[model samples]
Every structure is written in C-alpha cells, then in structure tokens.
Target: MSRAAIVVAAVACAACSGRMPVLDPGGPQAARIATYWWIVFWLSALILAAVVAFLLHTLAHRRVAAAPASLVEDTRVERRLALGVAAAVGLTALTLVVLLVTSVATGRALRSFGGTDPLTLEVTGYQWWWDVEYWDPVPSQRVRTANEIHIPVGRPVLVKTRSLDVIHSFWVPGLHGKKDNIPGHGSSLVLQADRAGTFIGRCAEFCGVQHAHMQLLVIADQPEVFDAWLQAQRRSAVVPTDAFARHGFDLFMTGPCALCHTVLGTPAGGRRGPDLTHLASRRTLAAGTLPNTVGHLAGWIIDPQAQKPGAQMPGNAFGADDLSALLAFLGGLS
Candidate 1:
C-alpha cells in the first residue's frame, strides 16, 4: 500500500479500536454524558452521509466542469440558505438548553437524601492514603469498620469527603466517577450501587509520589451482610495476652507511631495518618493498594517509605520482636 493508504488504514484502525472507550456508564451523571455523545455521533453520521450523496449527484450531472460562473447567484437560493443557517443555530441552542436542564435534574436525583435514614461516612484523603470513618449517628449503636466503603446495594450512601495535606479524588468506577478531596473544605458525594460486588476505585488526581499506588475498593452488598460487617468492625481492638501482640501494642504506643497515627480504644492520639482503629479488618493496606498480610504489614511498619515513596511515615528502627509485636497488634485490630 502507498504511504497515504497506510496512514488512512492506521486512522481507521484507531477509530475502530475501543480499548479505552468509555463503554460503560456506571452512574447517572456518566450515563447522561454518554447519552449526549451517542446522540451527537449518530446525528453527525447522518449529516455526513447526506453531504456525500449530494456531492456525488452534483458531480455526475454537471454538464461543463468549471463553467458555472455564468449561471449567477439566485436570490431565492440565498434566502433559503439564510433560513437554513438560522434554523440550525436555533436548534443548536435549544439542544444545549435541554441538555443543561436534564443534567441538573439527574444530578438532583443522585444527591437526593432520605430524612435522617441514610448511612453517613467520613472519607478523608491523606497524601496518598484513604482514611475511612463510618459515623454511627445513633447514640447506642456502634458503627462497623473497613478501609474501603461498603453500602447496601439499593440504598443511597452519603459520603462527606475531606483532605488532610493535599488534594485526592474518590472514584469508584462501577458506582460513581469521583469527587475532589480539598483540604480545609468539605465536599459531599451521594452515590449508590445497583448491584452487589466489589468494584475497583482509584485516586483520579495526582497528589504525590505514591499517587499512582493509591487505590480503593467499593463493596456493594446486601443490607444484612453490611450490618454484620459493621458489627465486626466496631469491636474493640484486641487486648492480647499473647506477649508478641502486647509488645507490639506497647511499641506502637510508645514509639514514633503514636505521634502520627490513631488507634481507637487506646491512647495513641495522633491524627496525621489513617486511623488504625480497625486496620486488620481492611482487605488492603496502604490506601487499598497492598494486601493486608503479616509480611506486607511488617514491611510497612519497618520502612514505609520503601513501599510508598514520599510518604509522611518514617522508618522504625526497632528489632524483629518489636516489629512482630507491632504487626501482631495491628493484625488484631479487625
């Protein structure tokens, strides 16, 4: 094939490849945006077909090529062209107005709240980690815990988003797109999942060196399962009679860890990192990027910067037993 032909073939192949196309609209807002694109695509295709057919007809029937200058412009033809342009402009404006109105309506539906019946979650973003806090507003009931957020499949979840140091985004691909977590100001995102499964989420904005490693999960489950999970999370951190776990707890509280992290039901009052109140219950550590296991947790505890560059956590210079105790104490948080 000629170079031009090869270039055309490449362009066609690129157009046909849907590898990164936004095939699925997970949320209502995304669905609306996808629908708008679909309408525009088909309409453009129809216009192109009409224009091509008209050009072919004109070329086939032309008597003398390049001799139409003597025909002169017709006033009626000019008037019809002006009317067509005006109609096109008016229709475009009307379409834009309709789209704006519908977008606002869909947004309102997504953000609608029940009268004090919805589950409220506090989602705080660190440099590259996600700090999840489930708020149980009821006085007597304890809220269950997990790193990733979980909600009932059919009910709307109200999430209040915040940031500690830099901006991060909360995005659950199969549920909702994202909302920015800006420091000093709170933003709210209302979303729901229509099905029950684990959906992958990621930090949509870059914050630091580990920004690419920061990811999260959204678990949509039946209400009963969510309730049980919550109960497990709210249980107090394990007060281990085992020497290793007890030593780890001591190392955690007395070492530099206490100055930067928080563990509920204990005196570690730090607020710089994620709350370790229920760390073991979380499926993934390091902001949902690493699996929660003894080895990974040990690595994180010993030298966090090696795993997560630019992390605010410093490496602990403790011995193996002390590290084991810390890992044991953390592992029992679930």
Candidate 2:
C-alpha cells in the first residue's frame, strides 16, 4: 500500500482502539520516559482548551464586521491572560523539578538498599560470550562459570562488569537495568530480586559482529540452593573417561586451542578468549547464542566464523577426530 494509505489505516486503527494507553507519569529509567510524555500531553491539552475557550469568547463578543472605529483593549482581560500564561509556565517548571527530584531519589534508593547479604558475580563480556565468576567472600571461595549468573532472591546482588575486547552491555529487563561493559574501564550494577526465578539478560550494547549473540542469564534462588550451585560449579574440571571425550581432551591440550582458551585444571590456558574454567556448566556457548551441548560446541569449534561472523576466534585446520576431541574436552570443562 501507499504511504498515505498506511498512515490513514494506522490512524483509523488507533482511533478504534478502546484500551487506555499507558501513561507512565513517574517510574525509573525508560519507565520515566512515559511520565515525561504524559506531562507534555496534559500540558498541550490544557493549552489547547484555553485557546479554544478564548477564541469562542472573542467570536461571541467581538465585532466581525469592521464598523467600530474606537475599539480598545481591556486592561483587565490583558492582565488575566498574562496571569494565566505566568501560571502555566510556573506549573510546568515546578512539574519538571518534581520529576527530576523523584528520579534522583529512586536511583539513590536502588543503589543504597541492602535487603540481605547477597551474592557477588563478576561478569566479563567478550566478543561473543559472557565469562561469569561467582565470588563468595564469607566462604572464602571463587567459582568460575560461564554465561549464566546465579544469585539469591530477596538480596541485593552486586555485579561487576568488564570487557576483554570492545564495549558490551549487561541488561536484564525483568529485574533492573542495563550497564555497559567497557575495556580497561570497569562498571558495576547493584540489582535485587523480589522473588525466586530465572531472569534472562543480554548484552544490550552493540559490540561487534556477533553482538546480538552475546546473551546472559541470571538465576535468582534461595540461599541454600545458590550455595549448592556454587559447590557444583567449583567442582574439578570434567575429565572424560569415555573414548571420544578422552580423545577430545587430548586433542584440545595438544592442539592450537590451548593458546586462546583456558580450562582451569587443564593445559588449555589461552587467556585471549573468555576463561572457560567451567565451560560446560554454562547454558549457552558463542556468548549466549547457542546451547552448551556437543552439537553446537562442535559446530562452533569447527567453524566459529560461520556461526558468528567476525568472531575474534579464528577457525583453524582440524579434521573430524581433532574437532571431536576438542569439543569433548571443552564440553567437559565444568
């Protein structure tokens, strides 16, 4: 259809809709945008109403045909109009001040509240994945993991953000907001959950070719469950006793893979990419694009460029056996 027709159709559809549009008068972050819009809407409506009222009064009392030679402006009417204009401007300014103060207060509260002792996760964003490290100070331990970040519900969780390559973003809509991960410059996000659930987050900023693929997951749970998960993540690297996985482990260690990737208890300590200390424990590979399974892992290992074009990971020469062995070893890293 033509542009004019599309515009007319959209307007007609909107006119026929019955639901009240959300007027976000005040909230936080993007939610506060609606509040600003609502203020504009009401201010415009009031101004239009005043203009229409004045025009109607002028049309009723003022002479249309030019017959009177000594028509004079009324001082009282002029003063009333000036007062109305002043009031409108003052009210608009006051509204803006209130909105700004409220937003500042909300942000301060979100930053300061300490609901309970919470888990701390250090999440580093890479070109195509997220490297997650669970740090518990009380237990005096650290657990290296991948894309999925776990926390305890009803607690204030602090997340530290860093980037290995370019800048990326960490965002979880259901819980809080987005924070950028920049190289050399470290940022932090303090978030909390009201209840227990799995909240999905992603790299909100555009970092590179596979920027869209950089996803992260946050699992909020009870304290006990979170502790158990910590223990599981801290377990020694999975050594595949099976023939294929064993061969894959050997191939991974002896091949060029060790130069860029790191498996905590193994020889593959290539720090160029995300430290895959607990690779298999992660939900997705390729920075949260694909699941951490044999198929996706194998495919990514074989041809990372095909899976994520412009990925920093260079796909080198490898046969089926070599690829299979590498996949097995990486997959068993947890």
Candidate 3:
C-alpha cells in the first residue's frame, strides 16, 4: 500500500490499537510462529469442510430399510468402509506427528541464536515492574534500568530472567514467545529483532493487584543508534543546574529516597527501587502505567498508592515547596 493510504488507514483507526502483535511480526521467531498458526488453521478448516461434505453426501444418498442386516450387507462395501476408516485414523495420527515435530523444531531454532558477541541482559520481575540490567565485561560499564530495553536490530540477545516474588512471564509477542520468570528458579531466552521499531511487553502471568499495569517497552534500533544509546546510559547523570534542582538533590540524598533509589554519580545508591539517574529520559512511569510528564510524575511521587492501589511506593508527604523542587530536579535529569 502507498504511504498515504497507510496513513489514512491509521488515522481512521486512531481510536483502536495500532497493531496486533501476534500477526505483526518483527522477528524471525514471531514470523515462524505466525506461519505455523496459519498452516494449522487452514489445514483444520479444510479438514472440517471435507468432513461436512462427506456427511452431507451420506445424508443425501439414503438406503431403504426394507431388508434385514444379513440380507442387505455387502462384504466388499464393509471391507472398503473399514479400510477407509483405518486410513483416516492413520492420516490423522501422521498429521499430528508432523505438527509436533515442526513445533519442536521451531522452538529449538528460537533458542539457538547464541553467538560470540550476543548482548546479555538480566531482567528481574517485581510485583508491578521490570528491573533490567545490561551486563558488560567491565563491571563499571554495566547499567541498571527499569521497564525499557533497547537492543540492536538483527543481533542476538541473551536475556536471563528471574522473579523477586511470584511467577511473571516476559513476552513481546511481535518479537518472541513468552518466557516465565519463576520465583525460585531463573530462566533464560534467546531473542532477536529483525525490524527496527518499538514493541510492548507485558507480564503474562498474574502476580498481584497491579498485574494488568505491569508493562515494558522493547526498542529495536540500528547498531550505531543502539551503541550511542548505550554510551549515553553508561554515563552518570548530569549535575543539577538551578537552585531548586540542587536543593532537591540534597533533599533526596538526605531523605528516605536515598535508601531505596540510586542516582549515578551521587551518594544515593539504594537498589530497592528503579534507578533515577536518567529517569527523565524514559517515556513512562510505574512500568508504563503513566506518561512521563511533569504532572504525571508529580502525581506518581506524591501519592503512588492513589494511582496504583497495590504500589510498593508509599506516598511522600512533601511540602509544596519541597515537591516543586523535587519535580524540578527529576525533570532536569535528562
């Protein structure tokens, strides 16, 4: 379709979802799965049609009930019917075996993308958030972020996942299948994106009251773009410029926020919450539940429990001046 046509269609459906992830594949794994689904769907449809036609033919051609069973029975016809039934059963079993083998092969292929330079990341599932840690050979170069992941297109990624509390599945249907993060046991998945775009991921398993709000974004970018992003994320946060921001930083370091959150280059090194070093760069707050705007950020920090009933973050009773300063500091993080 032409770009204009596509744009028109998008505008027409602006109120609806933009894409169906299962059908709109951005990776080889998702493409293969969608192919498998269509194959089975069409084959089953054909089989149902065939069965219905046969039943209709049988019903249309009726036999009179004038003779006894022994008198009217034909040995050749009975043998043929038996043979047809046996053949149908054998064919059904064979089809099932083929499908099973194909599915297994596809699964194995999806998991076999390991390479020498594969990007390795650790994703930990919280009650209503995802903590993502990008691993590097140099410990100092490692990065810890939340809810957003950026990867290079066409490069393999090794994602190790674990849950802090309960089972939560990590899935971006447009890129790959679901991988469960068990509470006691860890799991890993190999995934790659063939296209450069953003995909949404959600916790497939229910963990708590905020399960539905638990979401993440996977952004696939060009290699150069990804490298640039990595370099930016690796650096420490910039120093606050204005007085309000500077004062807010001091308040954060002295208050309870310092114990549960970390801001690189500063003394606030708490690991219990998401890193706030480059918090302003992110597009969403509370695991994609709220837009990353000054207003939404203020609401989230002032009363997290009011927005998310089971949120782990407690409401901070900051005075009007303190709140303004804090918001200024956070907003200037980018």
Candidate 4:
C-alpha cells in the first residue's frame, strides 16, 4: 500500500474505535456541556479571524508613508482612536459577561438533582475496579454488582461515590462530567440517559499501577428491561446441576478462592474482592482488562498478576482437570 493509503487506513481505524466520547453526547448533562463548548469554540474562532484580518490589513498598508509628521500629533485623530479602543474594550467586557452567565447557568443545570424519584447507585472505587451496588429503600431490594451499571432510559440516577484506598474519579464522558471519589469523604452526582445504549466509563484520576484498567460499562435500557435486570441481579447465583460443575463448586468453596471473593447464596462470603455471584453475566473480567470468556476466565484464575501487575487477587495453582471444572462452574453462575 502507498503511504497515503496506509495513513487513510489508520485514520479509519481510529475513527472506528469510538474513543472520543466527549464529542458524542448521550445524555442531557453532556448535551448541555457540548453546547457550552461549541459556543466558546465559535466565539474564539471569530476573535481569531478578526485578529488575523487586522494583521493582514496592516501588512498590506505597511508602505503608506509613515503618517505625515503633522497628522501624527492630530488631537482629533488621537481622540477617535481612543474612542475606538474604549468601544472595543466595552464590547469585550460585554462578551465576557455573557459567557460567564451562560457558564454559570449551564453549571447550575448540570448540578441540579430534582427528580421526585431517582434510582440510587452507590459506587465505591477500588484499586483496580469499581464496586457497584444498586440501592433501594428495602434492604432485600438492593443488588450488588461490579464494573457494570444498568439504568433505565429517560430516568434520573443519583450516584453516590467514594474511594476505598485512594482518590479516584468516576467519569462517563458521554453521560456526564467527572466526579471525584475521595477517600474519607463522599461525593454525589446525577446522571440520566436520554436514550437506550451502552456507554463506557473509566476512572479519570490516577490511583495505582492498574489505574488505566479501571473501566466500567453503563447500560441504558428501557424501563421494563432495566427492572428485569435489576430483579435478576438481586437474586443469588444459580446453583450448578452438572456433576463437573458441582465438583468445581466444592473445590472453589473449600479452597483459597473463597477467602477473598463472595458467591451469594453459598458458604463463601468473603468481601475483600469483587462479588462472583454474577460473574458470568458481566461483559469483562478484571475490570475491563479482558473479555469474559472461558479461556480468559481460566487464564485469569491461573495467573491474575500477569494480566494486571498490581492486582490484589493472587493466582491459584490447579491441575488441568480441576481448572477446567472450576471454569465451568464459574461460567454457569449466570
């Protein structure tokens, strides 16, 4: 391929990657932000054009015979120039005031949480993953999940955020602005999706060696679908009925795997790691580090540190048959 063809292919690949979320607004908050951005962008462009035109005009008239010595001291011309400068300054001030007011109004709109009934989600940022819990007034209604969040379309969601170890940021650029999750403190933000789609989220603040891997998915679904998903999440993990799966389950519960992770409705209730009750239901493993497939799951279980250098979970040593059984059991949790 020619150099130009290669360059075009590279650009096409980057465009297909869907990485520029800020430019593609998916919610009301992000739409408002995009509007503000465009306003400033156009205003800046106009000012730059004006400056460039003035410079070009000056260059074109550079040989106009340095203002006649007599006209250089003309009080009337000086007065006119002074008036022109004053007018320009006043106009600039007015523009600034307008921009300021627009910014303040947009900020207020973004911060407003005025829904009579909003879904509440408690998000706690861990070193390399997000611990997410769907909150409810009834204790039993609360559902615990990790890495992925589901919300109903056209409804407001109040997200309460905090950090367990260090400062982290919750940011879904297509949905809203970044909110800090500070340790020893609490912060909250409101997000609402205008349509049904899947959006990606990431930890904007640096936390540790695997900070870049701290990613999540925000799924906006129809009301019925979202409710059904919530109901499923609130239930315990499905019990395996196959003989191999049962054997794997026994090994998981009796071995070191149960020491850090929890499988709801089972004897394992460890809280130091992400919940495994709905592990197979998630799209990614190790917090978006790998696709949630049987091969990836087995690899992660055998050697987690190789995938994430600073991950908290340690690798487990299991024979080939035992590893296959364990993967089968975990994959059936959905």
TM-scores of all predicted structures: 0.77, 0.75, 0.89, 0.90
Q: What is candidate 3's CA lDDT for residue 163? A: 95
After superposing candidate 4 on the true structure, give the runs of residues whose Cα lies further than 4 Å from its correct spot: 1-20, 64-68
**Which consecutive 10 residues in model 3 have the weakest lDDT in total?**
11-20
Q: List the residue pairs that clash in candidate 3.
A: none
What is the per-residue lDDT of model 4 for residues 61-154, given as tens digits with 9 covering 90 to 100? 8875674766457788789999979987997998799799989999999888449898999999999899998988898788888999999999
Candidate whose lDDT is highest = 4
| CA error at residue 130 for candidate 2, angstroms | 2.4
Clashing pairs in 4: none
Q: In candidate 1, which residue pairs clash?
A: 144-230, 248-325, 248-326
Quote the positional error of residue 188 for candidate 3 in Å: 1.0
Q: What tens-digit string does per-residue lDDT give for candidate 3 at 164-214?
A: 888999988888888999889999987789989999888888788888778
By TM-score, who's the top model here? 4
The positional error of residue 40 in candidate 1, measured at the CA in angstroms, is 5.7
Considering lDDT, which of the candidate structures 2 and 3 is the better prediction for this target?
3
Q: What does candidate 2's lDDT look like per residue over 1-334, in tens digits? A: 9999998986566323122223411113324434444665776687688779988998889966776565797789789999989997997788678667766766776676544665677888877778777776654368766678888766677788998788888877666667888899998877776667766677778776566666777777788898788787776676678988898778777877778777766777787777777776677777566677889887787788898788888877788877766776676666
TM match of model 2 to true structure:
0.75
- lDDT (Cα, 0-100) at 100 in candidate 2: 75
- What ordering of candidates by TM-score runs from best to worst? 4, 3, 1, 2
